[model samples]
Target: MLCGGTSAARPATDETQQIADKVKPQIEEKEGKTFDVFNAVEFKTQVVAGTNYFIKVHVGNDEYVHLRVFQSLPHENKPLSLHSYQSSKTKHDQLTFF
Candidate 1:
């Protein structure tokens, strides 16, 4: 990937799921509802001062959501935050920058 450019989308790994899990509560609070199935299905990353994760999540059944999560640099010791999200999605939807 080019410097500061987002990487190509990748299939979600256990580590990716952990990253998604870290920001799940923030997402739930923002949406004012809880998800029964918050599973990371795919992801892309962009390196900034720290890193940005663009993830596709399976909320439950045919429902899905895309999340933009930010993780601060290790030394900063900040918690991951839900930078943005798109709800009411489906499994067929492509995971893109949003």
Candidate 2:
């Protein structure tokens, strides 16, 4: 058998766009609820296959949050990852990531 380890590649932008297209209805159709980038409280994302990334926005003063939303298993409740946290003196508003 010969070795052929080259894997196929797809554009990341396209994948992200596809996911957004699927979830647009939920974002816009929430009953009387508007997503203000400055006041983002929480977010939800779904993944059928491959990577689906939605951003976590915050509409606060310090702009302490600039994170991307993750696709989690519907049953599992996972906390936000704080791996890239910085040692700043500003207090950041708390927001839940789903």
Candidate 3:
């Protein structure tokens, strides 16, 4: 297995001390709308020099992905090692969030 490296450059940057308002829901939007998601392998970490406030959710697979999703959210009670993954057929079809 090949390990990946990291640097201080991420496309959706929030490096500086700043906060923005969330206008709408991420998964749902009106007509003629689209949202960008990072469907990549080396996407596990988006490290800043010295910070623990950063948050990333890798909801889907990284290697040989049937699906991939990466997003930055404010810190939640959810653990960082914790992820949402289910490979079986029945659970995947029934699972839905709102």
Candidate 4:
């Protein structure tokens, strides 16, 4: 039973790495033009109705870009939905989605 449980967990880790690998370049390309340094700081996963993964990237020293993957139906081959935004110090009247 323990061995089965360990085997089951491997795929989830691999999937998360795959998602990160795919998304990192896109974010780097976009943010690279603006920030001098771009690096991934952390990755967080949330499983609610579906699996959601968040990648936290640091742009320069202060600014940050958040990359989110929303999988409405987990384990589907269809492209996972992606949402990303750069953090701002100034307050905005309205929220923006990208």
By TM-score, the best candidate is 1
| TM-score of predicted structure 3 | 0.17
lDDT of 2 by residue, 5-27 (tens): 21222223544444434443354
Q: Which ten residues in a row have the lowest lDDT in candidate 4?
A: 3-12
lDDT of 3 at 29: 34
**RMSD list, candidates in order:** 1.0, 12.0, 14.1, 9.4
C-alpha lDDT of residue 88 in model 1: 91
**Clashing residue pair totals per candidate (backbone < 3 A):** 0, 2, 0, 0
Q: TM-score for each prediction?
A: 0.93, 0.27, 0.17, 0.45
Q: Against the unseen true structure, what C-alpha lDDT does each candidate score?
A: 0.91, 0.34, 0.25, 0.52
Instruction: State candidate 4's TM-score.
Output: 0.45
lDDT for model 2: 0.34
Worst 10 residues of 3 by lDDT: 16-25
Model 4, span 19-92: residue lDDT tens: 75566666667656645554555555566556666655555656666667666664565666665655542221
- Candidate 1, clashing residue pairs? none
Model 4 gets an lDDT of 0.52
